[model samples]
Target: MNKIHYLMNREVNYTLSKCFLTRLTGWEEVPLVKTDACGLVLFRFNNDFTGLRFKLVLNDIEILTAAHIHLGMRGENGQVVAFLFGPVTRGISVNRGVVTGIIVESDLTGPLQGMSLLELARKMEIGNSYVNAHTENHPNGEIRGQIKRF
Candidate 1:
């Protein structure tokens, strides 16, 4: 697993390019847990004529986001391969398909911690940060999530 840490002093933006997508592994049936501070925002997309795009909302706003992921492969084949995120509210299930981009917002006014950067941000007890996910698999770099905090 990769790890990235930031003693954030300003707002940061992370982007996922096509090359980044090619290197992403271990993204199957991953459970995105919500923490006391941050939340996971997943963007769903499709290539079909009637392609669908929507946000998979987690049920509870305060449930800590944590889970072990089993990454899988996606191709031209059209199948319902979605990563089930959060133990959200009753009847409000959150899932995304054919992820095109993901960006995590780390709103920090102090220090942070967690299993991964996302986990740390989620569990953070300070400012607001958003993790925008285009794919379910967490990216690898000097830090996790390919993030940059100013």
Candidate 2:
């Protein structure tokens, strides 16, 4: 039997530590960091048995995708927020059928589109968020996730 886990009433955040190229049906991690860079933020909303994620890019721009999603974005003020929503599935399907009912927001804007995270990784000199702009860059960062058991 499929154990029905209820994510229908929770909201969580996943901090993406690495850039990735995603398909409509699966995920592929991308190595987009060579030096220090700020990671993006993923806001997930569980609604009526569906999983939704959200994020923001430069200029307060936003983007949305399904749970089985992939994205690479430009960090804003040191972070990006992406919005996504759809059925939540675990494991993997050897072959996924055609994708349907993908819910994209009306206000959705392409922030990472045509942008290269790899290039950003090369040009940006990651440094302390709390440090002065003239300080030396630190080529290191971290991401953390916390979950609460109901």
Provide the lDDT at 114 for model 2.
45
lDDT against true structure, model 1: 0.23
Alpha-carbon TM-score of each model against the true structure: 0.17, 0.20
Which candidate has the top score in TM-score? Answer: 2
lDDT of 1 at 10: 16
The top-ranked prediction according to lDDT is 1
Candidate 1, 1-150: lDDT as tens digits: 123434231123122111111112122113332322222333322221122122323322222232111222221111112222332232221232222323222321223211223333222212122232222222210001211121
Query: How well is each residue in 8-56 modelled by candidate 2, as lDDT tens digits?
Result: 2122112222222111110111212232212232333333213333341
lDDT of each: 0.23, 0.23
